[model samples]
Target: MATVKTVTTADAAAKLDELLWVVLWQPLGLPRDIRHTLSLEGEEFELLAQENGQVVGGLVAVWTGGTEIELRHLAVASHAQGHGIGRSLVTEFYRIAKTKNCERIHTIARNTSGEFFRMLGFQTAPGQAPEHPIFREHGISFELMERFVEQGTPADCSTAARSRGG
Candidate 1:
């Protein structure tokens, strides 16, 4: 059985860095400039999946202000990819996001993951505009997908609501 745990302290950060960043992202050209950005943030969390004490997969998210959590990284062992590990990671992140009172979560998924995120009920932004944080970054231009905790509060709606009394 696999157990999932939240990364909360420096020790957890070490484990996470070993499994997720060094082992995975570095091989895929995620850019070294983003390494400092990946360091533990005051509002971020790492969800780790371990079986019999050996880490298998991870998902990292950071609260991006005003009740939104942004997925920084997510991956399952290449050998573990087909066994629902990815889905479980996202679901767990959603559970954590709700617990943290975040009204929504977002991620800038690579083209390869378009279908994966779609299966999890994430929708791509309908415009070419760089409205999402992930897009405003200096080195990437991936599709941004967002999942909302409340049905009617679309990304644009949240901005609109702030100008009203609702």
Candidate 2:
């Protein structure tokens, strides 16, 4: 059985360099410039999947203020891709977001991962313009997908109560 755990920023600061290269940089063919600049120093959340004491997948995301979060990186070791590790990681993240009262979550997904995001209920943001500046600056031809969280809040019937009291 695979177990998922949060990767602390302190541990990520040291381990991300190796994991990113093996799981994303080489496999995804990310540019060296981008890989070199990736840092977990200021990340707000991260998670990793472990089996037999070896990490099989991980993700990093940022709290982009005001009830919004953006996923920065999500990678599963090539050997572990089809075994539901990615799905579990995302599910855990969604649960965390709900607890934090996040209203929405989004990610810039590459073509390969777009379907996976869609499968998890994310939809392409409806707009002709890029929703984020980084998309334009990087010249990355990717889709911006988002999902709104439905938070249950107590219903207020203040006006009716006041009228009845009067």
Report, for every candidate in turn, its global Cα lDDT versus the true structure.
Answer: 0.69, 0.70
**How do the residues 4-37 of candidate 2 rate in per-residue lDDT, one tens digit apiece?**
7787667654464466568656644566556547
The TM-score that candidate 1 achieves is 0.72
Q: lDDT score of model 2? A: 0.70
lDDT of 1 by residue, 1-166 (tens): 6677888778767776777765455665576546566554547678988767777788888888879888878877766676767777777777667666788788877666767777776777654624435533534346888877654333333233233432
For model 2, how many clashes? 0
Error of 2 at 4 (Å): 1.1
Please give the range of 10 consecutive residues that has the lowest summed lDDT in model 1.
154-163
Candidate 2 lands at a TM-score of 0.74
The residue ranges of model 2 lying beyond 4 angstroms of the native Cα positions read 28-43, 127-140, 152-166
Local error of candidate 1 at residue 82 (angstroms): 1.2
Error of 1 at 67 (Å): 1.3
